[model samples]
Target: MLKRVIQQFQLDVLATSEVEDSHSSTVYKCTLSNGENVYLKIPFTKLKYQRELEAYEILKGKVSIPEMINYWSGDEECPGAFLLSELKGKPLTSAAKPTTAFQVGVLHAKMHSTQPPSEQVLNGMKNEFPNWSHFIDQQFYSFAEDAKYILDERLYQKAIEKFERMKQQLPLSDGPSFIHMDFRPANIIVDNEQVSGVIDFESVRFGSTEVDFSKLYRDFLSYDSSLYSAYQRGYNSIRPLIDLEKVLPFYRFTDAFNSIGWCKRRGNQEHALFLEENLARLKKWLL
Candidate 1:
């Protein structure tokens, strides 16, 4: 398969190594004989391949997507693959000035500015819910059933009750926009406090921009409240601030619930306990 990709691209490779342990794809770093390097992502699933391939096409000239070097796909049983130029920079998590939340917000604002086209994959999906509250309620119940064995009944019931009460507070929104659902520090690349690139478009979707803000808040804001102001300043510089402050608490609750579900299923005692501790933090808003 590697030989086919290199031959298809008519490129000479010096060596290749597995660089990213992707859940749905195998990512390889190919250093060519001439010292130029490129990444090869071979999908283990059709859906992931289709999404990543199409995502790159849609995001081609609009954003900081990697340049496609070569590609192949559409086999029922065989994995699809593509080659891309390597994005230069260190991951924001470990980079200097990593806490520069302003940069993060600016990048997201830039992405959200590009509305998803009507025929975009995520826009085509017909996911329905009566309202945001119904969605949150369903989230709790959907995982609540499975959580019974994973969590102490008393703790589980407390969470359900708390989130149910928050249901009334769920805010309404205008419509969906293109966003990185997994918009976190790890997926961002930073150079000298500026974002050099945003990677991982597999989970790209047209959804409430708040869904992503919630993720950012949960993953970063909780750790540093200073980021809230910096991020807002940067984001608003691109577009006027909406009611993000008013609605963020509700989304934070939802984010916590999602984390709880993931931790429960992971069955890691430490992670589960962390969520239990998280409950204490959430009480500030949920209660």
Candidate 2:
């Protein structure tokens, strides 16, 4: 695969090492003969590949992201590949300080404030919907179908009822904005406490800005209220923060529910722990 990528992109590679933590794609850290370092990513699915390429093209100057150096649409023997300029620094971990979260918040605020160049660009992204509620409706019911068997009868019914109630009570989306659907510490690159770049554009989309916060809160912010407050402060420094308190519970619940359904569909024992975790989350939400 690396040899073919090198030939197709005409890259002079000196050495390459695989990134072990890349779950949805095969990523390689390639050091070129001329001393430039780049990432060669080949996504496992066509959807992810298309989203990443479109995101890079549309967000070239609007956001701080890895540069897309070159790309190849694969044939029968190979899959599509993207050669991206390396974003410096390590992935932000749980140990990162409140200041780092503030930086991430500022970066995220910039993304949320950016409007697509035109309706054509907005419609081109595969993940856009009419509004926040529409997206949630689609996701909740579809995931419910996948997770029906995973949850007991009482819990499943409670989830349905909760979604219906949430639909009536949730506020209208502020407006369509560019969002990193999977924004989290792992996708954020930081050097010496400053965010250098954000990576993993496969989930980029035009949608509700508030929904983007669900994953970050679930995996990071919930651990420390101080971090959350600092993040909100940073975001408000750029633009006013949304009424997050009103919508967070609903978004967080849906995010957890989606994870459970995704794990069940993957049908791997390796996902057992994740499945159990989301199941517990659902029960808590339903209660």
Candidate 3:
């Protein structure tokens, strides 16, 4: 079906291979007749496809994100997907140097610096929530409800109590900057030790930079102190990150719980248990 769609589109597909095969979507790298490379994102659900499209539209010019070559919606026989010009370089991996984290930090700050029309477009999504805090509050309760059986009740309750207290002490910021929302090394492509492009913006929206940074810290920085400090140096150089004391901790805890809930949902027992065993490790960040 995908092949037919490509042929019908008059694309001279020189060669094609699966680049990323994930639950949500399967991205194919296509080498066109003209020798130009592009990626096609075919999501499992319509919602993910739509999310990807919206993200590209809202963010194409805001930062060093991929450019949309075409947003294709096929007829009844065919399907819909996005064709994006290939981003330069490879994914940042475990082999990356600490300096790569700093480069990512700099790019993140630059992305956050994007204001106005771009932020408006991104943040304007899902207006059902009053604000960022409201959106997070709703998610937190939802996470607790979903993980109640999977996690220890007392530990979960303690987490809620701590979070509620922190919420009261934390000051909420007005208006959001465009945040990648899923900022991390794997989503970042680096070339010559510099950030070339950022992918996986399906979760992109108008939100706090703190939440974005928290995911990075939770994923890699917690283990590598050098990476953490370098990232801080890179980020702080562009713009001072806000809400570090009260708000950042909330995001850190949220990332852990969210990961656990998602892993359990996917029946990924190994990862879920890994998250559970290391749950206590997130406490330092919580306080």
Candidate 4:
């Protein structure tokens, strides 16, 4: 299908074509006749296509985000939708040193500062689950159920109880902001010690700033306390730190559950270790 699209579009050279990630998408790296490198991302679902397109449109020119060169809808010829863009630099893991947590902290802080046009912001908000609790209870809960065997059910239940209590104690703040809901090391591309590009905006949504921060810290920074401190320092440089005392437990709970889901879905053995480790960590923090 992609080969046919390349021929139809007059693409001269193809560099790479393969399944990119867990999502239902095929990514192709192609070199055009004009010698420009381009990337094509094909999505299996119409909802995914529309969401990704909307995110690309909103994020274009705002930061080092990919520029959409063209978009093709599903038709008799192509059963799925595809979007083409200039191929960005290599993934951070490939070309550069792992970004320091402080660097990610600064990047996220800057991202949160970004405000989209009023209508776009409103539309994004409408698409997101109303609150963090609902998102966790619905999305995270269902995912957790699949990996229940790997988790310590007693600890998990306690964490859930703690999460509910913390949710009630959440402090008031300025409402929602545009969030890269899945911001993590894997989704970023770095070159020359700087973030060259951000990819996979599928989880992009309007949500609490902390929710985005939780994803980054849990996935990466939590591995190193030094990194966590560095991230906090970088983030505090942009915006004042919120009183996270109330929400920390809930965030940790969400992180453990979400990681379990990822591991189970991917058939990852290390995920079991991660669950046990995070469960212990959460217990210590909560106690």
Candidate models: Cα lDDT each: 0.67, 0.82, 0.69, 0.63
| TM-score attained by model 2 | 0.91
**Candidate 4: where are CA atoms >4 Å away?**
4-10, 19-24, 33-35, 76-88, 93-103, 120-130, 149-156, 223-230, 233-238, 241-246, 262-287
Name the best candidate (by lDDT). 2
Question: Measured by C-alpha RMSD in angstroms, how accurate is candidate 4?
Answer: 4.2
Query: How high is each candidate's TM-score?
Result: 0.78, 0.91, 0.81, 0.75
Model 2 global lDDT (CA atoms, 0 to 1): 0.82
Quote the positional error of residue 44 for candidate 4 in Å.
3.6
Tens digits of lDDT, candidate 4, 35-125:
7777777666665666677777776766567777667766665644454665345554422333455566666777676654576543322
Question: Candidate 3 lDDT, tens digit per residue, 172-276?
Answer: 663366676777767888887777878876665666665677767666677777887788788888888675655667777777776666666666664656566
Number of clashing residue pairs in every model? 0, 0, 0, 0
By lDDT rank, best first, the candidates go 2, 3, 1, 4
Ranking by TM-score: 2, 3, 1, 4
**Residue 38, model 1, lDDT:** 92
Superior candidate under lDDT, 1 versus 4: 1
Displacement of residue 180 (Cα, Å) in model 4 is 1.4
Instruction: Please write out the lDDT profile of model 1 over residues 55-99, one tens digit for every residue.
Output: 677677766657887788735555678889988876665223424
Residue pairs in collision within model 3: none
